[model samples]
Target: MKGLCTGLAAAAVFMATGCQASEPPTQVVYRFDDHRYLELKGWDCEGELWYTDTKQGVHSQIASQFYRIFTKKFVHPSERYIAIPWWGNITGGFSVSKDYGQTWETGGASMSPGENEPDGSNAPYYDDVLSFTVVNDQGFLQTKHRLYMSSKPFDDPRILPGGSGITYTASDGAVHHIKPTSSGPAWGLDYITKQGLKEDTAQFKTNYQGLPDKVPEVKGYTGWDHMRCDMGVGR
Candidate 1:
Protein backbone atom coordinates (compact mmCIF):
# COMPACT_ATOMS: atom_id res chain seq x y z
CA MET A 1 0.00 0.00 0.00
CA LYS A 2 2.78 2.47 0.80
CA GLY A 3 4.57 1.62 -2.45
CA LEU A 4 1.42 2.37 -4.45
CA CYS A 5 1.07 5.77 -2.78
CA THR A 6 4.70 6.66 -3.50
CA GLY A 7 4.35 5.72 -7.18
CA LEU A 8 1.28 7.96 -7.59
CA ALA A 9 3.04 10.94 -5.98
CA ALA A 10 6.06 10.51 -8.25
CA ALA A 11 3.81 10.39 -11.32
CA ALA A 12 2.06 13.59 -10.24
CA VAL A 13 5.36 15.41 -9.84
CA PHE A 14 6.52 14.31 -13.30
CA MET A 15 3.32 15.55 -14.89
CA ALA A 16 3.63 18.92 -13.19
CA THR A 17 7.17 19.39 -14.42
CA GLY A 18 6.19 18.50 -17.99
CA CYS A 19 3.41 21.06 -17.98
CA GLN A 20 5.71 23.78 -16.77
CA ALA A 21 8.30 23.02 -19.45
CA SER A 22 5.79 23.41 -22.27
CA GLU A 23 5.10 27.08 -21.65
CA PRO A 24 7.20 29.37 -23.86
CA PRO A 25 9.16 32.30 -22.50
CA THR A 26 8.53 35.85 -23.69
CA GLN A 27 11.52 37.69 -25.16
CA VAL A 28 12.17 41.09 -26.65
CA VAL A 29 13.41 40.42 -30.18
CA TYR A 30 14.03 43.99 -31.27
CA ARG A 31 13.53 47.44 -29.80
CA PHE A 32 12.59 50.30 -32.13
CA ASP A 33 12.84 52.61 -29.17
CA ASP A 34 12.15 52.66 -25.46
CA HIS A 35 8.38 52.59 -25.91
CA ARG A 36 8.13 50.69 -29.17
CA TYR A 37 9.66 47.27 -29.67
CA LEU A 38 9.16 43.72 -31.01
CA GLU A 39 8.96 40.55 -28.95
CA LEU A 40 8.87 36.80 -29.37
CA LYS A 41 6.95 34.28 -27.30
CA GLY A 42 8.25 30.93 -28.40
CA TRP A 43 10.97 28.43 -27.63
CA ASP A 44 14.51 29.33 -28.64
CA CYS A 45 14.62 31.53 -31.79
CA GLU A 46 11.45 30.34 -33.51
CA GLY A 47 8.32 32.45 -33.00
CA GLU A 48 6.07 35.23 -34.35
CA LEU A 49 6.74 38.97 -34.34
CA TRP A 50 4.66 40.94 -31.85
CA TYR A 51 4.82 44.73 -31.99
CA THR A 52 4.41 46.80 -28.84
CA ASP A 53 4.03 50.56 -28.88
CA THR A 54 3.50 51.66 -25.29
CA LYS A 55 3.25 55.33 -26.15
CA GLN A 56 0.46 54.67 -28.64
CA GLY A 57 -1.16 52.01 -26.47
CA VAL A 58 -0.84 49.46 -29.24
CA HIS A 59 0.29 45.87 -28.96
CA SER A 60 -0.42 43.26 -31.62
CA GLN A 61 1.04 40.55 -33.78
CA ILE A 62 2.12 42.39 -36.90
CA ALA A 63 3.79 39.41 -38.57
CA SER A 64 3.27 35.71 -37.96
CA GLN A 65 5.64 32.74 -38.06
CA PHE A 66 8.82 34.80 -37.75
CA TYR A 67 12.18 33.02 -37.53
CA ARG A 68 14.93 35.19 -36.12
CA ILE A 69 17.66 33.58 -38.18
CA PHE A 70 16.11 34.24 -41.61
CA THR A 71 13.87 37.30 -41.35
CA LYS A 72 15.12 40.90 -41.06
CA LYS A 73 13.16 44.10 -40.44
CA PHE A 74 14.09 47.71 -41.20
CA VAL A 75 12.26 50.63 -39.65
CA HIS A 76 12.63 54.22 -40.75
CA PRO A 77 14.08 56.62 -38.21
CA SER A 78 10.76 58.41 -38.09
CA GLU A 79 8.98 55.07 -37.55
CA ARG A 80 6.61 55.84 -40.41
CA TYR A 81 7.97 53.37 -42.93
CA ILE A 82 8.77 49.72 -42.26
CA ALA A 83 10.08 46.94 -44.47
CA ILE A 84 10.65 43.25 -43.98
CA PRO A 85 12.72 41.29 -46.48
CA TRP A 86 11.70 37.64 -46.45
CA TRP A 87 13.51 34.83 -48.26
CA GLY A 88 12.75 31.16 -48.58
CA ASN A 89 13.46 28.17 -50.74
CA ILE A 90 10.36 28.41 -52.94
CA THR A 91 9.17 32.06 -52.57
CA GLY A 92 10.83 35.37 -51.71
CA GLY A 93 9.72 39.02 -51.59
CA PHE A 94 9.33 42.08 -49.43
CA SER A 95 6.57 43.14 -47.07
CA VAL A 96 6.33 46.91 -46.85
CA SER A 97 4.26 49.26 -44.71
CA LYS A 98 4.22 52.94 -45.52
CA ASP A 99 1.83 54.05 -42.81
CA TYR A 100 3.38 52.86 -39.55
CA GLY A 101 2.35 49.21 -40.08
CA GLN A 102 -1.36 49.87 -40.31
CA THR A 103 -1.45 47.87 -43.56
CA TRP A 104 0.99 45.76 -45.55
CA GLU A 105 1.73 45.09 -49.24
CA THR A 106 3.75 42.18 -50.58
CA GLY A 107 5.01 41.70 -54.13
CA GLY A 108 7.94 40.93 -56.35
CA ALA A 109 10.63 43.44 -57.25
CA SER A 110 9.70 46.32 -59.54
CA MET A 111 12.56 47.92 -61.42
CA SER A 112 12.71 51.48 -62.72
CA PRO A 113 12.97 52.30 -66.39
CA GLY A 114 16.36 51.44 -67.89
CA GLU A 115 17.16 49.26 -64.92
CA ASN A 116 16.32 45.88 -66.47
CA GLU A 117 18.32 44.30 -69.22
CA PRO A 118 16.90 43.25 -72.55
CA ASP A 119 16.75 39.57 -71.62
CA GLY A 120 17.05 39.73 -67.82
CA SER A 121 14.08 39.73 -65.49
CA ASN A 122 13.07 41.94 -62.60
CA ALA A 123 11.89 39.15 -60.33
CA PRO A 124 13.81 39.11 -57.05
CA TYR A 125 15.19 35.76 -55.96
CA TYR A 126 15.78 34.62 -52.40
CA ASP A 127 19.49 34.04 -52.79
CA ASP A 128 20.07 37.23 -54.77
CA VAL A 129 19.24 39.57 -51.89
CA LEU A 130 22.16 40.34 -49.58
CA SER A 131 21.01 43.24 -47.44
CA PHE A 132 18.37 45.96 -47.10
CA THR A 133 18.18 49.30 -45.27
CA VAL A 134 15.89 52.30 -44.96
CA VAL A 135 17.66 55.65 -44.85
CA ASN A 136 15.60 58.83 -44.52
CA ASP A 137 12.64 58.33 -46.90
CA GLN A 138 14.39 55.96 -49.29
CA GLY A 139 14.92 52.18 -49.31
CA PHE A 140 17.97 50.37 -50.59
CA LEU A 141 18.24 46.67 -51.42
CA GLN A 142 21.63 45.23 -52.12
CA THR A 143 21.58 42.02 -54.10
CA LYS A 144 24.36 39.65 -54.99
CA HIS A 145 25.15 41.44 -58.25
CA ARG A 146 23.79 45.01 -58.01
CA LEU A 147 22.71 47.70 -55.59
CA TYR A 148 19.14 48.97 -56.07
CA MET A 149 17.71 52.17 -54.66
CA SER A 150 14.16 53.42 -54.33
CA SER A 151 13.61 57.07 -53.47
CA LYS A 152 9.81 56.80 -53.43
CA PRO A 153 9.68 54.44 -50.46
CA PHE A 154 10.16 51.04 -52.11
CA ASP A 155 7.95 51.64 -55.12
CA ASP A 156 10.24 51.03 -58.08
CA PRO A 157 13.85 50.31 -57.15
CA ARG A 158 16.52 51.42 -59.60
CA ILE A 159 20.17 50.58 -59.87
CA LEU A 160 22.43 53.11 -58.22
CA PRO A 161 24.53 54.79 -60.85
CA GLY A 162 27.42 55.41 -58.49
CA GLY A 163 27.08 51.84 -57.15
CA SER A 164 27.69 52.11 -53.39
CA GLY A 165 30.23 54.31 -51.52
CA ILE A 166 27.74 57.21 -51.68
CA THR A 167 26.71 59.06 -48.53
CA TYR A 168 23.15 59.54 -47.25
CA THR A 169 21.48 60.76 -44.07
CA ALA A 170 19.76 58.38 -41.66
CA SER A 171 16.81 59.05 -39.35
CA ASP A 172 19.29 59.98 -36.63
CA GLY A 173 20.46 63.02 -38.65
CA ALA A 174 23.82 61.30 -39.11
CA VAL A 175 25.43 61.02 -42.53
CA HIS A 176 26.11 57.45 -43.51
CA HIS A 177 27.37 55.58 -46.55
CA ILE A 178 26.37 52.17 -47.91
CA LYS A 179 29.05 49.55 -48.30
CA PRO A 180 28.07 46.82 -50.70
CA THR A 181 28.56 43.33 -49.32
CA SER A 182 27.91 39.73 -50.27
CA SER A 183 26.05 38.82 -47.08
CA GLY A 184 22.76 39.75 -45.49
CA PRO A 185 22.14 41.33 -42.11
CA ALA A 186 23.49 39.22 -39.25
CA TRP A 187 20.42 38.13 -37.31
CA GLY A 188 20.38 36.36 -33.93
CA LEU A 189 24.03 37.25 -33.38
CA ASP A 190 23.64 39.30 -30.24
CA TYR A 191 21.43 36.74 -28.55
CA ILE A 192 21.13 32.97 -28.29
CA THR A 193 24.18 31.33 -29.79
CA LYS A 194 26.50 34.32 -29.87
CA GLN A 195 25.65 36.07 -26.60
CA GLY A 196 23.78 34.18 -23.93
CA LEU A 197 20.13 35.11 -23.43
CA LYS A 198 20.92 35.95 -19.78
CA GLU A 199 23.23 38.78 -20.88
CA ASP A 200 20.83 40.01 -23.52
CA THR A 201 17.94 40.00 -21.09
CA ALA A 202 19.96 42.05 -18.61
CA GLN A 203 20.77 44.63 -21.28
CA PHE A 204 17.10 44.90 -22.19
CA LYS A 205 16.23 45.46 -18.57
CA THR A 206 18.64 48.37 -18.43
CA ASN A 207 17.64 49.80 -21.79
CA TYR A 208 13.90 49.68 -21.20
CA GLN A 209 13.99 50.37 -17.50
CA GLY A 210 10.73 51.78 -16.15
CA LEU A 211 8.84 50.69 -19.26
CA PRO A 212 5.62 48.82 -18.75
CA ASP A 213 5.97 45.06 -18.54
CA LYS A 214 2.30 44.28 -18.94
CA VAL A 215 1.13 42.96 -22.31
CA PRO A 216 -1.31 45.39 -23.85
CA GLU A 217 -4.67 44.27 -25.15
CA VAL A 218 -4.19 43.38 -28.82
CA LYS A 219 -7.20 44.50 -30.81
CA GLY A 220 -7.49 41.49 -33.18
CA TYR A 221 -5.43 38.75 -31.66
CA THR A 222 -7.31 35.53 -32.36
CA GLY A 223 -4.95 33.36 -30.34
CA TRP A 224 -1.22 32.78 -30.24
CA ASP A 225 -1.66 29.02 -30.46
CA HIS A 226 -3.68 29.29 -33.66
CA MET A 227 -0.95 31.27 -35.43
CA ARG A 228 1.31 29.17 -37.65
CA CYS A 229 4.46 29.94 -39.65
CA ASP A 230 3.51 28.57 -43.07
CA MET A 231 5.32 30.81 -45.52
CA GLY A 232 7.55 28.08 -46.96
CA VAL A 233 9.26 24.78 -46.29
CA GLY A 234 12.00 24.42 -43.68
CA ARG A 235 10.32 27.12 -41.54
Candidate 2:
Protein backbone atom coordinates (compact mmCIF):
# COMPACT_ATOMS: atom_id res chain seq x y z
CA MET A 1 0.00 0.00 0.00
CA LYS A 2 2.78 2.43 0.82
CA GLY A 3 4.59 1.72 -2.45
CA LEU A 4 1.35 2.08 -4.42
CA CYS A 5 0.62 5.37 -2.71
CA THR A 6 4.08 6.65 -3.46
CA GLY A 7 3.65 5.73 -7.13
CA LEU A 8 0.24 7.37 -7.28
CA ALA A 9 1.49 10.47 -5.53
CA ALA A 10 4.33 10.68 -8.02
CA ALA A 11 1.83 10.16 -10.84
CA ALA A 12 -0.48 12.87 -9.46
CA VAL A 13 2.41 15.25 -9.07
CA PHE A 14 3.24 14.53 -12.70
CA MET A 15 -0.37 14.91 -13.91
CA ALA A 16 -0.58 18.10 -11.87
CA THR A 17 2.31 19.29 -13.99
CA GLY A 18 1.32 21.25 -17.12
CA CYS A 19 -1.76 22.21 -15.06
CA GLN A 20 -0.93 25.55 -16.58
CA ALA A 21 1.84 26.91 -18.75
CA SER A 22 1.12 30.53 -17.89
CA GLU A 23 -1.29 31.82 -15.23
CA PRO A 24 -4.68 32.92 -16.64
CA PRO A 25 -5.68 36.59 -16.77
CA THR A 26 -6.52 37.04 -13.08
CA GLN A 27 -5.25 33.77 -11.59
CA VAL A 28 -2.33 32.32 -9.67
CA VAL A 29 -1.21 28.71 -9.47
CA TYR A 30 -0.63 27.08 -6.10
CA ARG A 31 3.07 26.63 -7.08
CA PHE A 32 3.77 26.30 -3.40
CA ASP A 33 1.34 27.14 -0.58
CA ASP A 34 2.90 25.92 2.72
CA HIS A 35 -0.52 25.18 4.23
CA ARG A 36 -1.41 22.85 1.34
CA TYR A 37 -3.15 19.45 1.28
CA LEU A 38 -6.73 18.63 2.45
CA GLU A 39 -7.53 17.88 6.08
CA LEU A 40 -10.47 18.15 8.45
CA LYS A 41 -9.96 21.39 10.33
CA GLY A 42 -12.68 24.02 10.15
CA TRP A 43 -16.17 23.15 11.44
CA ASP A 44 -15.73 19.44 12.19
CA CYS A 45 -14.71 17.77 8.91
CA GLU A 46 -11.88 17.52 6.38
CA GLY A 47 -12.11 18.71 2.74
CA GLU A 48 -11.04 21.33 0.21
CA LEU A 49 -12.47 23.54 -2.57
CA TRP A 50 -11.06 23.12 -6.11
CA TYR A 51 -12.02 24.74 -9.46
CA THR A 52 -10.73 25.22 -13.05
CA ASP A 53 -10.95 28.10 -15.48
CA THR A 54 -10.23 29.13 -19.11
CA LYS A 55 -10.37 32.55 -20.74
CA GLN A 56 -9.53 33.78 -24.27
CA GLY A 57 -6.77 31.16 -24.74
CA VAL A 58 -5.15 30.65 -21.36
CA HIS A 59 -6.30 28.10 -18.77
CA SER A 60 -5.92 28.01 -14.99
CA GLN A 61 -6.76 25.93 -11.92
CA ILE A 62 -8.04 27.21 -8.57
CA ALA A 63 -8.23 25.63 -5.09
CA SER A 64 -8.78 26.89 -1.56
CA GLN A 65 -9.56 25.94 2.07
CA PHE A 66 -12.11 28.61 2.97
CA TYR A 67 -14.45 27.25 5.69
CA ARG A 68 -18.13 27.62 6.57
CA ILE A 69 -20.74 24.94 5.88
CA PHE A 70 -20.00 23.41 2.51
CA THR A 71 -16.71 25.24 2.54
CA LYS A 72 -13.91 23.39 0.71
CA LYS A 73 -16.11 22.90 -2.38
CA PHE A 74 -15.63 24.00 -6.00
CA VAL A 75 -16.96 22.66 -9.34
CA HIS A 76 -16.90 24.08 -12.85
CA PRO A 77 -18.63 22.72 -15.95
CA SER A 78 -17.62 25.43 -18.39
CA GLU A 79 -14.43 27.40 -18.20
CA ARG A 80 -16.37 30.66 -18.05
CA TYR A 81 -18.58 29.97 -15.02
CA ILE A 82 -17.71 28.22 -11.74
CA ALA A 83 -19.94 26.87 -8.95
CA ILE A 84 -18.28 27.62 -5.61
CA PRO A 85 -19.85 26.71 -2.19
CA TRP A 86 -18.05 28.83 0.41
CA TRP A 87 -18.70 29.11 4.16
CA GLY A 88 -19.65 32.36 5.83
CA ASN A 89 -19.82 33.45 9.50
CA ILE A 90 -20.14 30.41 11.80
CA THR A 91 -23.46 30.15 9.92
CA GLY A 92 -23.31 29.51 6.09
CA GLY A 93 -24.09 30.91 2.59
CA PHE A 94 -22.36 31.47 -0.84
CA SER A 95 -21.13 34.09 -3.30
CA VAL A 96 -20.29 34.44 -7.04
CA SER A 97 -17.58 36.20 -9.01
CA LYS A 98 -17.36 37.01 -12.74
CA ASP A 99 -14.18 38.96 -13.50
CA TYR A 100 -11.75 36.18 -12.75
CA GLY A 101 -10.27 36.54 -9.23
CA GLN A 102 -11.26 40.15 -9.04
CA THR A 103 -14.41 40.06 -6.83
CA TRP A 104 -17.10 37.95 -5.09
CA GLU A 105 -20.69 38.60 -4.01
CA THR A 106 -22.91 36.66 -1.55
CA GLY A 107 -26.59 35.93 -2.21
CA GLY A 108 -29.83 34.65 -0.54
CA ALA A 109 -31.65 35.72 2.65
CA SER A 110 -29.57 37.08 5.49
CA MET A 111 -29.59 35.43 8.91
CA SER A 112 -29.17 37.34 12.16
CA PRO A 113 -26.94 35.04 14.28
CA GLY A 114 -25.56 31.53 14.16
CA GLU A 115 -27.91 28.52 14.51
CA ASN A 116 -30.91 28.92 16.84
CA GLU A 117 -32.84 32.14 17.47
CA PRO A 118 -31.13 35.25 18.79
CA ASP A 119 -31.60 33.83 22.31
CA GLY A 120 -30.47 30.29 21.35
CA SER A 121 -33.84 28.74 22.23
CA ASN A 122 -36.42 28.48 19.43
CA ALA A 123 -35.00 27.63 16.01
CA PRO A 124 -36.64 27.95 12.60
CA TYR A 125 -36.87 24.96 10.31
CA TYR A 126 -34.15 24.81 7.64
CA ASP A 127 -34.21 23.02 4.31
CA ASP A 128 -31.48 22.47 1.72
CA VAL A 129 -31.29 26.18 0.98
CA LEU A 130 -27.52 25.74 0.51
CA SER A 131 -27.21 21.98 0.14
CA PHE A 132 -25.64 21.82 -3.33
CA THR A 133 -23.56 19.43 -5.48
CA VAL A 134 -22.18 19.74 -9.00
CA VAL A 135 -21.00 17.08 -11.47
CA ASN A 136 -18.20 18.85 -13.31
CA ASP A 137 -20.68 21.73 -13.76
CA GLN A 138 -23.04 19.72 -15.97
CA GLY A 139 -25.88 19.55 -13.38
CA PHE A 140 -26.20 20.37 -9.69
CA LEU A 141 -27.65 17.95 -7.11
CA GLN A 142 -29.39 19.07 -3.90
CA THR A 143 -31.35 17.02 -1.34
CA LYS A 144 -34.68 18.30 -0.02
CA HIS A 145 -33.60 19.03 3.53
CA ARG A 146 -35.84 22.01 4.20
CA LEU A 147 -38.94 23.23 2.40
CA TYR A 148 -37.95 26.85 2.85
CA MET A 149 -40.54 28.05 0.29
CA SER A 150 -43.42 25.70 1.03
CA SER A 151 -45.51 24.23 3.83
CA LYS A 152 -42.98 21.40 4.28
CA PRO A 153 -39.76 23.32 3.83
CA PHE A 154 -36.67 21.13 4.23
CA ASP A 155 -38.67 18.10 5.27
CA ASP A 156 -36.42 15.30 3.92
CA PRO A 157 -32.81 15.95 2.98
CA ARG A 158 -32.02 12.34 2.26
CA ILE A 159 -31.03 10.31 5.28
CA LEU A 160 -27.24 10.41 5.60
CA PRO A 161 -26.42 6.90 6.61
CA GLY A 162 -23.66 6.30 9.22
CA GLY A 163 -22.07 9.50 10.44
CA SER A 164 -18.78 8.07 9.12
CA GLY A 165 -19.08 10.00 5.86
CA ILE A 166 -19.97 13.52 4.82
CA THR A 167 -23.66 14.60 5.11
CA TYR A 168 -25.66 17.78 4.95
CA THR A 169 -28.52 19.03 7.13
CA ALA A 170 -29.94 20.91 4.11
CA SER A 171 -32.05 23.04 6.41
CA ASP A 172 -29.66 25.38 8.26
CA GLY A 173 -27.08 25.03 5.47
CA ALA A 174 -24.77 22.50 7.09
CA VAL A 175 -22.62 19.87 5.29
CA HIS A 176 -21.46 17.23 7.71
CA HIS A 177 -20.59 13.50 7.54
CA ILE A 178 -17.54 13.24 5.28
CA LYS A 179 -15.57 10.22 4.10
CA PRO A 180 -12.64 10.02 1.74
CA THR A 181 -12.88 9.49 -2.04
CA SER A 182 -10.17 8.53 -4.52
CA SER A 183 -9.91 11.98 -6.06
CA GLY A 184 -10.60 13.76 -2.81
CA PRO A 185 -13.15 13.07 -0.06
CA ALA A 186 -16.50 11.40 -0.78
CA TRP A 187 -18.48 14.57 -0.13
CA GLY A 188 -20.78 14.53 -3.14
CA LEU A 189 -24.61 14.19 -3.22
CA ASP A 190 -26.38 10.91 -3.92
CA TYR A 191 -30.02 10.78 -5.07
CA ILE A 192 -32.55 8.43 -3.51
CA THR A 193 -35.69 7.56 -5.49
CA LYS A 194 -37.80 5.94 -2.79
CA GLN A 195 -37.17 8.81 -0.43
CA GLY A 196 -38.29 11.26 -3.19
CA LEU A 197 -35.57 13.60 -1.95
CA LYS A 198 -31.85 13.85 -2.47
CA GLU A 199 -30.19 11.87 0.33
CA ASP A 200 -26.96 12.76 2.00
CA THR A 201 -24.97 9.85 0.58
CA ALA A 202 -21.81 10.83 2.47
CA GLN A 203 -20.86 8.26 5.12
CA PHE A 204 -18.87 9.13 8.24
CA LYS A 205 -16.14 6.76 9.28
CA THR A 206 -15.66 5.50 12.80
CA ASN A 207 -12.12 6.84 12.91
CA TYR A 208 -13.20 9.93 10.96
CA GLN A 209 -9.63 11.15 10.60
CA GLY A 210 -8.53 7.72 9.31
CA LEU A 211 -9.24 8.68 5.66
CA PRO A 212 -7.89 7.33 2.39
CA ASP A 213 -4.35 8.32 1.55
CA LYS A 214 -5.36 9.54 -1.91
CA VAL A 215 -7.87 11.87 -0.26
CA PRO A 216 -4.98 14.21 0.58
CA GLU A 217 -4.67 16.11 3.86
CA VAL A 218 -6.68 19.20 3.06
CA LYS A 219 -7.72 21.67 5.75
CA GLY A 220 -9.55 24.23 3.59
CA TYR A 221 -9.06 26.31 0.46
CA THR A 222 -6.09 28.62 0.29
CA GLY A 223 -6.88 30.66 -2.86
CA TRP A 224 -9.44 30.51 -5.71
CA ASP A 225 -10.12 31.52 -9.36
CA HIS A 226 -12.28 30.50 -12.36
CA MET A 227 -11.57 29.05 -15.81
CA ARG A 228 -13.34 29.15 -19.17
CA CYS A 229 -16.03 26.66 -20.19
CA ASP A 230 -14.26 25.60 -23.37
CA MET A 231 -11.16 24.71 -21.42
CA GLY A 232 -12.61 21.76 -19.58
CA VAL A 233 -10.40 19.19 -17.79
CA GLY A 234 -6.84 18.43 -18.91
CA ARG A 235 -4.92 20.85 -21.11
Instruction: Report the number of the highest-lDDT candidate.
Output: 1
Backbone clashes in model 1, listed as residue pairs? none
lDDT of 1 by residue, 1-76 (tens): 9999999999999999888877766666555557766666666666666766687776766557754533432333
Which segments of candidate 2 are over 4 A away from where they belong? 1-81, 87-91, 99-102, 106-131, 134-141, 147-235
lDDT of 2 by residue, 91-204 (tens): 332333333323333341122222223233212223332333322212132323321110111112222333233454555787654333321211211112112222223222
Q: Whole-model lDDT for model 1 versus the true structure?
A: 0.44
For all candidates in order, the CA lDDT equals: 0.44, 0.29
The positional error of residue 137 in candidate 2, measured at the CA in angstroms, is: 9.5
What is the model-wide C-alpha lDDT for candidate 2?
A: 0.29
Best by TM-score: 1
* Segments of candidate 1 deviating more than 4 angstroms: 1-6, 70-78, 87-91, 102-119, 125-128, 136-138, 149-235
